[model samples]
Target: MEPLGRGDPRARRPRGAHGFVRSRDGLYRPEELYDATPYSTSSDARAYQWSSEDRSPDALLTRALHDESIDQALGRWCDPRKLVGVMGGHAAERGSQEYADATRLGRTLGATHTVATGGGPGAMEAANLGASLAEADDAAVDEALGVLAEVPSFRPSVDAWVDAAWRARALCPTPSPNLGVPTWFYGHEPPNVFATSIAKYFRNAQREAILLMICDAGIVFLPGAGGTVQEIFQDACENYYATGDKVAPMVLVGRRYWTETLPAWQLLTALARGRAMEDHVHLVDTVDEAAALLNRPPVSRPSAPDAR
Candidate 1:
């Protein structure tokens, strides 16, 4: 499959106060990351390589600068209060019910809010795919889904998986924009292509924090393993410390899975007790219910901190 272009010419570089340097180097555009043959030569691959091998002070400084640049861009363009995040496992295959549910959740939320995710494969990719096709009809979405099912997972071949997504992307030429915060730390899980705007970082901790913080409208936790659980409590901690007006809703889908399987809901509910976030926390049976709960007016805007 043919890769995308190297960079976005449409992006305006941020000029320095002295009008000499372009201060904001900016994050990799979707095209920039995907462009090249054999995935190894792609910008995503090269960036991960550098992040993995580098240890010099200059490299650290550059990584910090790059992440800060991305933060500045997000600040200027996206309304953090309107961002709704979806957190789930990366193992959900494309044709699976879990993937389909995440996709529907994203489409529904994307109708009103900008969908955001961890930006890797599985549920993250599904949500991004749904958001991208938010403006399309059901038939078009179904067609795209069918196209993606050809390559369900990124395991055997990430290139094949990406190609399938690219094929699916054609169904919605003018895709609804969405945000993705991926990290190089998890290099095994390549970033998905459906995220129109990707804010990829070298540090996973910074990426996770930024992803959770920007979802001011709140986050919907899809059934997932360890990573999803971490997001739930991380978001809960933010809401737990937030004032009454600043607390964002946290909706967890799959009551039985969370309560019986993982049993995180018990602790989550207990933690919400006697706090401003008590009423904001909810347990739902489906993504439909989660979307409905988060469809209300947005809470106070949460601050988006720089990666440094």
Candidate 2:
């Protein structure tokens, strides 16, 4: 073993009789310099070098934090007039009806508005892919799919995800820029390649929270699991409290899921009937219906009386 560094008390040891003999080739004799000051210094240098070379953990964390910041910045760029977000499960499989439906929804929204997502595969990829392909020429669509073909699914390498997205850009391009707010915590689920821009984050909670906060236009909820449930409640809380930018509409895509399966629609309806939350909730069974609800103007309320 060797002294850790210059600040270490053991580093002050005296040199040996041969003044710590060194080879002409610049290597020191191990035994002669074991307890020597130069040896300690060398140990410290090696330690420093090792630390510098081992940046995997720090690099991953740094990227995660950067993703959070990027998401916030992208949220700022979204035009509330035309920005629409879809919330659903990441587990949606490629080529499934749910995925295809979600993609069609994205394509419809992309024609006239910007579509946003959590930036992973399944629904996210479908939407982005739909939008990208819907707007591009056939040749462009082919190129775009080629780029995305590298990582067509979520459970794969990050490089594949990134490369696919880059290639897609060369093929089916966006008429209007869109955003992807993904997180490094779920690094396995790479951001969708179809998004014109990305807002990646390290912290899942912060990413989810911020996403709900900035979706001022509205949110369309699809069938999903834990993460989706979390988002639904977070949005409900915001609406319940009349938080920032006022409460936007909450659109549920599938009637069965919203009304029967999870039954969030019933819960929201009950809440809305109460004095504290009246008129703040709406439920729709289809995408067209959801779109109509989203486009409806905000309701007006009587102003509070002023104190004399």
TM-scores of the models, in the order given: 0.88, 0.66
Tens-digit lDDT string for candidate 1 (1-308): 11222464423443222221123445456777888878888878877776787676666666666677777877665754489899999999999999999999999999998999999999999999999888899998899889999899988998899889888998788999898889889987999999998887777898898889888888999999999999999998888888777788999999999999999999999987767788889999999999999986654443433222
Question: Which predicted model would earn the best TM-score?
Answer: 1
In candidate 1, stretches whose alpha carbon ends up further than 4 angstroms from where it belongs are: 1-25, 297-308
Q: What is the C-alpha RMSD of each candidate to the true structure, in Å?
A: 5.9, 14.7
Candidate 2, 159-229: lDDT as tens digits: 44455555656554334466566664675454565666666555678888877877777788888887887
In Å, residue 271's CA in model 1 sits off its true spot by 0.6
TM value for model 2: 0.66
Q: Show the lowest summed lDDT stretch of 10 residues, model 1.
A: 14-23
